[model samples]
Target: MSVTDEPLLSVDGLQTSFYTEEGEVKAVNDVSYQIDRGERFAVVGESGAGKSVTSLSLMRLIDDPGRVKGGDVTFRSTSAVATLARKFPEGVATENSPGYIHVTELRSESGAVGSDPGATVRDNPTDVATSLHDGSLHIEAGHVDVLDASEDAMRELRGNEIAMIFQDPHTALNPVYTVGEQIAEAIRKHLEMDDGAAKERAIEMLERVGIPDAEERYSDYPHEFSGGMQQRAVIAIALSCDPALIVADEPTTALDVTIEAQILDLLKELSNEEDVAVQLITHDLGVVAELCDSVMVMYAGKPVERSSVEELYYEPKHPYTVGLMSSIPRIGDDRERLDTVPGTMPDLVQLPSGCSFHPRCPYAEDACLEHEPPLVDVETGEPVEDPDPAVHSAACLEYTGELQDGVDFDVQIREDAATDGGESV
Candidate 1:
């Protein structure tokens, strides 16, 4: 499968929650998306918007207080398509003077564009064919229902087929083990290689990731490496098995600007070279525009908007998305005060009855405070409604028919002030 082909991973109606001592907190509510092979998809939001937790949920890595309460995640293996073209020798000089030689050459000499030469390609074409015969898989490219697989099934899919790089490299890397040993361990576990082979592969991966003296550095501890080097090592571990998909959660948060740019470039290069889909989770919309093909904007545990990188940065639809775009400082913008999205994020334990963002949105209406808005299609100035499903979908009452002309923010401020015991606004 190629990047232009249909998505290999699909998620639908994902609802994740945490059973905390305080109460159950719904972290992710009704999240859905599809990630095609070799695509760089991004999940962007403020803290507590469930971006990190969503990545964890996809890998079934949630533990302790957190659990995937509901939803489905389907993963398919993709590969390069190889078409065999056979050529026979025109005149046989040897043999019985009538011998035929079959010269099998790959079609499209530019390297079999859409073929799956890797074992990580999991989209079972055989199963698909059998299902078509007996009716099992039954789902079309875009219409496939998200799969509700068991833990064991998901475990088999994770790491080998899908791998995740956490936000903090310091914490993600094992301080006690040598960087080489850890990478080798991951390779051995996922690739099923012996210790020696895994070590060799680990050194290769280290060198591929631009580590200095890869062989010697393999025995180096995590603390011995700089922030950028640690990040590269983590990426090496993530790509050890050549996973079909990689979920990177804020991989550049701790690095300096120069290091951050390098890491981003490295990730982009790896994604292209390995032909692996990447799910980049971060709060930096700038990074999203730089790295992601499509972007999902989440707020208060729900996706407020989802659109392509250009559409999101240019013609943003959701109010929240617009606020975020405006919040980014431009080079020439010189105003006394920078615009900020008013009001703090709500308490997840006890969210508002209606639109969660209504309390903070400047354009929010009275109806927004009374009823929750359903994410739906809306006709704008154009004669025809936008058919791009991924363009823009917002959970805001303003998009709906119900509109309240003017609503005072005084009530909300008073309530918040009282909640904080008359603290300064």
Candidate 2:
């Protein structure tokens, strides 16, 4: 497969926990997914669902008391591949055509093949071997284990390859510095450009993110701008280095509806134009419906359901997912009260015995209280130990045929509601 065909990010069996005074709290548990290049993915759930924690873990920003205990986070590094080619040009040979190279052919002066001199190719074939394809110079380098990388390595990776858009713009931006200066600092530090060049790039970023009169706003402080403007500034900084993937943790929090819509649109536009992948974390299903191609519904630190936006909205399998969809306020619905999932999120430190969501799951039975159901394919009802990131799956006993009643829900998509911009559930 071409480099573009491989997943940009692969997270497997990710387990992040916090060493709290109360006890060890499992903030993120066995969460796994993948993000393809230029793909828009969403992580949706209520507060304390581990959505933010998961993002922080991926970014290696989890502070004191919290630890990413287990799992593998593999990321494709184009810069690493480029560095390899520069360091060992003799080892890289053209394969079929111009953008294709056989990395295994790399050999040192000693005629030894590998990343290091005097090492056989068999020693580190997969870890050091790179690939080129698609006629676009898309270098598919060996995967970098983010969790295992050193602090210095992480510093190099952050903001350059992977960037983050924090939840609150006010808190994210520094009050002491001009917003333009902050963006310029990141650009200069990563791209090694002079101050004037970085400033020009920063102004370009601000304008690209739709700031009005970008050149004039270059000197404006964070407090001088409105909430929406501050958010735009934050986005500009996040996009300053032209990162390959951006982990946006609720980019539209606390904004007015119009501003939120604009921010979402800007993200979509940038992702399309820049070919950057996006991993959006939000509690709002509306945002997911508006922007994301695929959705992973997390609950109490684990994904309970995973599918495309259309499939999840139209044919939900897990009861928790059903409850979430049911709770959305439909414009044409006549019900006085919107449906709500019963009970709050379980305490992470002392999560219940079997399934973490069994207490709140409407279809929970005795089996659910005794055994946690594995995530399984919705159609085949077979346990998926290693699920394809894009496939539809859910972690509920109903899929396993253990629940006697079997979970069922109807999604009524009104024919005329589409034209009127109304919703039905």
Candidate 3:
């Protein structure tokens, strides 16, 4: 499917922090990216890179200590009318007006403009009100700034419009409830289907996710399913509501190689078949290569590199991204040990003075240690205040003409690159 004119999800200058007695740990700082409809975007980095925290902040799942300090997350919803009706029951009128009103024009009871019960969203006609029902207004589409949405509005959107597939299925799934019942519960709540209808839809979703004997497995609990099956069940629940975006946080991390491939294939198939956008968070570059079209490499809670998968793999601009690509094992490797990025991520509370990765960077220079670099366009080599998702950019002193001897790297291609030479990691 072609990408829509408007992006499905747009995040700008997102800053999330965790307050502790020691100090405030900036888990996600100035993270921004966009996901178009049916686009598969990958966020890859080492453990403390704020990949998961970024996703959590987007979902508004951050707790008290860990709050989203600043940022804007705008989402385009498919079922805006129903969601808004449920969110603002009092605003609904019995009068059947067959006129279209832009979502931004329809104010809540508090007279606040936007879909939120109390918050605000930008004025845009992307979402148009279609008609008014017995006690609800029907909207064809809508845009919502989730940050401004109230808790109740967020609850209506969470399972209904945006769904998350957590890393561990064991914790995501309710151990006491049957897998089918869990899926049915989400269908009933978000979809407003009856008991029988929800149960049938749940079984269908189970089958769609590749569960064997879904009918028989309906009554089975989480313990009854294997690791892979449990993960599939979680996927079924996430897909039950047909969310526009699915944030899969290391969905295959806990499964074995064989099962991991199955899960990856399933996700790829579902994303294409369902035409659902995906925000895949994983540390594995191999998985990113297989499933993602666009890639963002995050380091120290910031996007160090952003580009198409092919461009990122062939011509990585940032040293950190180059190091990550170099660490991946190739098909014909004779080295005793694989190359690894030196040193761990720095403490977020007290980051390095200049470039956070300067201490571990191989080509670091005096300029790199003295000044931080903004994301620069790869072609123009100019700094970008607000990056465009489609543009290839990297955060490196070399990009900004600060490094004396610039970072050097090359992608070697063998003569017989098709069969065995140009194998992806």
Superposition error at 156 for model 3 (Å): 0.8
Error of 2 at 133 (Å): 16
Error of 1 at 103 (Å): 33
The superposed Cα distance between candidate 2 and the true structure at residue 161, in angstroms, equals 0.6
* TM-score ranking, high to low: 2, 3, 1
Give the alpha carbon lDDT tens digit for every residue of 1-425 in model 3.
22246788889999999999989999999998989888899999999999999999989999989999999898865365445544554333333321111243343333434334212222222332334433222344456667766677778778778899999999999999999999999999988899999999999999998898999999999999999999999999999998889999999999998888888888788779878899999999888878888989999999999999878877788989888877877766666787789999999999998899999999988888788888889888887766577789999988777778888878665455433224323
Clashes of 2: 1
Candidate 3 wrongly placed segments (more than 4 Å)? 1-3, 89-141, 414-425
My TM-score estimates for the predictions, one after another, are 0.76, 0.88, 0.87
lDDT at residue 369 of model 2 (Cα atoms): 88
Each model's lDDT comes to 0.67, 0.80, 0.80
What digit string (tens of lDDT, one per residue) describes model 1 on residues 282-318?
9887788778888888888887776677666655667
Candidate 3: C-alpha RMSD to true structure equals 5.8
